[model samples]
Target: MEKAWWKESVIYQIYPRSFNDSNGDGIGDLKGITQKLDYLKDLGIDVIWLSPVYKSPNDDNGYDISDYQDIMDEFGTMQDWEELLHEVHQRGMKLIMDLVVNHSSDEHAWFVESKTSKDNPYRDYYIWRPGKEGGEPNNWESVFSGSAWQYDEATDEYYLHLFSKKQPDLNWENEKLRDEVYKMMTWWLDKGIDGFRMDVINFISKVPGLPDAPNPEGKKYASGGQFFINGPRMHEFLQEMNQQVLSKYDIITVGEMPGASVDDAKLYTGHDRDELNMVFTFEHMDLDSGPNGKWDLKELNLLDLKENISKWQNGLNGVGWNSLYLNNHDQPRMVSRFGNDKEYRAESAKMLATFLHMLQGTPYVYQGEEIGMTNVRFDSIDEYKDIEILNMYNEKVIQGNEDPAKVMQSIYVKGRDNARTPFQWDDSENAGFTTGEPWIKVNPNYKEINAKQAVNDPNSIYHYYKRIIALRKEHDIMVYGDYELISPEHESIFAYTRTYGSEKLIVITNFSSEHVPFTLPENLKLTSSELLISNYNVDKNEDVSSFTLKPYEARVYIGK
Candidate 1:
């Protein structure tokens, strides 16, 4: 097997809307990102995967793209984008743009034309089906908690939108639509971008006939994913995309696939598949959700997380690659979600970083995660801006059986906007994100947890992440090493070993606040090992035979 450059690379995902704001326009922009290039460079990341900044209706924040070629005016002009790309390259870093071709905003030209007339040339650009009986084309449901098909009075048909009704799914079955997507992709690749982070790419291919999904709830909308996600011609379309656009560019590609299985992942990212470099699977991320796939106040066990991660690590060991991440634009903060954020935010943040980065995969750090950001708490639902959360809140609580206040509490804790809040830069008003009011409320704890504070504190999570990333770059074992789960029976502690060639690294992390003692494995001798890094202080030349770890403590030891 050949080693891929991206396999050893550390990717930093920037939710541009929250990263920085340069124009005092209440939103982050490319210029602000350009100003932070040095910050990222100093962090020792190789690739920067920015969330979508294309022209959009802001329906799904920026995921519902309306124009592919132009930059969103809210972000900046084309010149600003070019400068950002140039600055990234100048610092020896690569830039990967989000590819959201799975769907486009209903306001997009193609969708507009498709809805205008049935005979329009662009009518085939989007999925349109004649109404069945008296209503929608099918009983499919949108991910945002409503009907998937929206009736168009002008066309006398219903258009499919797997997400928000404002966002219409594209017709991947159309060859012309595929060509148009390829052309836009090539245009960006030609502009010197490094790669793409495909958004919900698996949702592109859908089975024809627009069959009604089985209603497990006996309602119109349950299990609609059967007709869409991982459809019959997904690989066929992906291979065509790779051959036409991706193959010509030596670039990295990761697909956001929710329902994809181990076998499906092997097909999408295997060395011989030629589809993608990696994929972001949602199984680990969705552990806290209810059986209905909605947010629930459920506790995620550390052992379950470890088991799921290990399964993927071992499954993709020799076949494909994995993209490891703890938090992103769609998820809450890692420290708050997985660690003791209130009691040991700093230590646990560093511990979480160590636990994730030492795994057998490419690591992606969301903006502000390096500084141990926490989830936001809004006063009310009106304070939120994420469409999905609002829809869920309304459906499950406001008009349904669940308690409205309880649902709101869950939204405050797990809403996507928690990650989308403007990056807190200082204690200033708006957390120094913008002079004007930010699009989303900044986390109130920004005063103490902002970037300015973290940068100046040597014991901060930011500095720890920087050190860990530098260590990865300096040691091949940290990047390309094989991962082995150790002490799997431990309840509150997660331990693993990474070995490459003759080097061996043992990473141990305490997932809880309580102190725990563990006796070293008798079969393994580590008398010659040295502690490379530790969240808690260690006595000089301390023995590893038996050790007690403080709350949220972690250590990385390299064998001599």
Candidate 2:
């Protein structure tokens, strides 16, 4: 297998709208990111993946891009973006911009022209079908709730919007549209940007005939993913993209691919595959969801989590690479979701970080995750801003047969907004995210858990992350070693080992609040084992004989 730079690098995901506000406009901008380059560098990040900052209508909070080549007015100008890219490269770091070509905002020029006249040449740039009888063309459901088909009275046709109605899916079957997309991607690569994080790139291709999916509940709406995700011509499109644009530049590309199986992942990222370097799979991320993709608020079993991770690790061992992550803009905080957020927040956050970073793949740290930030709670659904959450609240709480308060509680605990809140920089007003009112409310726990306080405390999650990243760079095994799950049968603890050459690292993490005694694996000698890192303050020479692990404690030991 070829050695890819991104394979051995740690990528940090930055949600631009919440990272930092430089112009006092209640929104983060490019300049703010430039100012924070030193912070990222100090944290030992090798690649920075900035979420969508392109021209948008904010319908899906920048995901509904209106222009691919231009920067959004709120983020900054094109000049600012160029300067930021230069700064990142100068600091020995790479920049990966979000490539959201699956759909475009309804305000985009192509969509505007497509909706103008039925005979327009650009009409084929988007999916358009005549209404069925007196209703929508199909019973497909938008990811944001409601019908995926939006009726255009002018043309008497309905357009497909897998997400919000304001965002319409692009017609990839058109060769002209594909060329345009490739041209735009090459333009960005020509500008010296490191690479791209393809947004729902697999959803760009759709099954032919636009067939109506079987409605399990006889409801008018359900995810149309079955008809679109990883469509028939997905590989062909990706291979063409790689040959025309990506192959020209030695840049990293990670696709946001959902509903992709292990075999499908091999097709997209295998050594023989030229489609992508890696892909973000949602198998582990969707553990808490119900059978119908709705919130169920169930507790995650540690053994099940380990099994899930082990399957991906072992399945992709020799075939493809994995993009490991605990939290992103679309998911809640890891500390609050996977780890204990109330009593042992700091310890559990660091433990979770240790577990993820030591995995045998590229690791992504979402902004504010290093400092143990958590979910946000609001009094009403009116306080929420995410389109998915708002739509779910309306469907399940306002219109369906579910309790509004219970639905709101699920939203508070598992909604994407929990991770979208402004970065908590200090204990000051608005968590020091902006001088003006923030676009979203800051987490109330910011007063006790902010960057300002963590930076000065040696026992903070922020410093722990810095140390682990430093360790990864110091030891080559941490980056390219093979992973092996050791204590898979443990109920409340997860243990794994990473080995490369003569170096071996054993990582043990307690996933519960109750202290548990664990016996060392058989034949594992401790005389030569050196304690590398621990969430708790333990001396290097501390005896391990019958040692009992405290709640949420994690330790990494290095040996022959």
- RMSD per candidate (Å) reads 1.3, 1.4
lDDT of 2 by residue, 484-552 (tens): 898789999898888878888888889999999977787555557888899998777666534778999
Candidate 1 lDDT, tens digit per residue, 334-401?
Answer: 88888878978898999999999888889999999998989888888899888888889888877787
Regions of candidate 2 where Cα sits further than 4 Å from its true position: 542-546
TM-score, model 2 to reference = 0.97
TM-score of 1: 0.98
Candidate 2 least-lDDT 10 residues = 538-547
